[model samples]
Target: MNKSKIVVIGGGTGIPVLLDALRKENIDLTAVVTVADDGGSSGKIRNAVNIAPPGDLRNVLIAMSDMPQFYADILQYRFDETDGPLAGHPLGNLLIAAVSEKQGSISTAIRTLGRFFHISGNIYPSSDQALTLHAVFEDGTEVAGESSIGKHEGLISHVYLTDTDTGGAPIASQNVVNCIMDADMVVMGPGSLYTSILPNVVIPDINKALLETKAKVVYVCNIMTQRGETENFTDADHVRVLHEHLGKKVIDHVLVNIEQVPQDYMDNNAFDEYLVQVKHDFAGLKEQEVKVISNNFLRLVKGGAFHDGEAVAREIMGLSKRQAD
Candidate 1:
């Protein structure tokens, strides 16, 4: 009656939603979060303290924590502009930064915070050092920084990590690689393909481990297209990009949403960052030899579309069982 080992990789809001659901299941969960974020409270803190961005890690920690509602609220509390220099910064980000500085590494700080919050799952930053996400546009122009990649108007040619001379590329810690290699199942995305998910996998060691792992790798496709990142990307197109980057047939299953989004439910002006619903591409998926699990995995909240975490988790559990069988 051993629990299955599941390693979820990615960053941003989508990942936390998935983790929130996964935490309720009987599994050994480990969240390997991206550290390429250089915007908002995370960016400010990282620049000032020279540490990995902790915003994604904080969200993932809270999602898997067994703490009371009040504690979660306190960690996520944000200050207003009236608060001066600390304006718009979440309390958790500052705390993580302080702990990272004190402990001499983000990995240690994350573990300390996890213990403090009584997290149900393990959390690891993709890298110990701060990594910058650099992208080359289709026109050969290049943009540096995860926050700035979306601002470019051209299609992204490819993205790679900079700011390190270690083989001239950013690298993942050995601990992160070992977790992936040992997992029974590895889940990727439900987040921004380029910024959130790919930033973690593109690390040479991680990419190599993904190819070597015996785990059932599952990719949860986004329900909608992101304006700057994946403007018109289809479900299959998403998988294709991943395959191209990882340079192998690592993905075993792709969980996609087939439920149609209501035309008017999405307020473009309010959610201007999101462009359109991600088009279904079963044919393309078939061509890629990826087993497609399509279902009504949509949950609408406040005029925006999101993955139904419980539904997605159920599918993941089924996949794990099937793999075991």
Candidate 2:
């Protein structure tokens, strides 16, 4: 018997949460993170080093690693904004950038770190080059850059990517296609639909592999709608958008949160990106013929909503175990 190989896809803070929990499962875990980040610390390094942004990669590595907490803290440490030459940059990002230059690609840098840091499983960037996300809004408007897409006020119609250095079509990072193709299951989301998860699947080779792979594709829907990306969207709408982009219904299962958030818990000042809770659409989901695993997957803390990663991980691994059996 072999360990079930599962590939978790997406980026941002959400993927790391799931990765942390999924690492505990008795299965083979691999994180296929998006490279289309151009925001804050990631943006700075992507510009300076002309490589895939390392912010998401850094978080994923930390989540997968069993290193001492003190070592993790040192890698995650940030210099004070008042300090010169090192302000706002995480030590992990610098380490990745240095290793990327030495190793010649972000994929190799991640591989090197994963082995040396004792990561539980694999972490691969979705692409080798730094990618810029471009969005076309419903109002006949276009925006470039991942950070700008969220800040720009308009209903996004679709999003795409281009190479940061040469403006060429984006290609799958080394091992990403093979991982997806070989997986027993592929997981998507709990991250930004447009700027994070979609960026990876929208890549030409990645998309092709997804279409050809026999693995079960599960979408972990967000608990809350994002202001700029998914405002006023129903749970089924999320799947619809993904289906539209992928040219057919590819996602096999969706994990939706059914529990309602208690009133007065959300602090808008701290977590401004999240808006109202996502509405349910069981009929719509049924119409798409996708399995809906609705549950009380919400974890409300410090005035914001998040998925209970352990709970979701349990569901995911349960499915994997059944398939293996």
Query: What would the TM-scores of all predictions be?
Result: 0.97, 0.98
Q: Please count the clashing residue pairs in each candidate, in the order shown.
A: 0, 0
Per residue, candidate 2 scores C-alpha lDDT tens digits across 132-184 of 89999999899999998989898899989999899989988759999999999
Error of 2 at 271 (Å): 0.2
Candidate 1: minimum summed lDDT over ten consecutive residues — where?
Answer: 162-171
Output the TM-score of candidate 2. Answer: 0.98
Ten contiguous residues minimizing lDDT sum, candidate 2: 316-325
lDDT tens readout by residue for model 1, 194-270: 99999998998999999999888999999999977898899999999899899977799999999999988997877
Q: CA lDDT, every prediction?
A: 0.91, 0.91
Scored by lDDT, model 1 comes in at 0.91
For this target, which candidate reaches the highest TM-score against the unseen true structure? 2
For model 1 the local lDDT of residue 128 reads: 89
Stretches > 4 Å off in candidate 1: 164-167
lDDT at position 312, candidate 2: 92
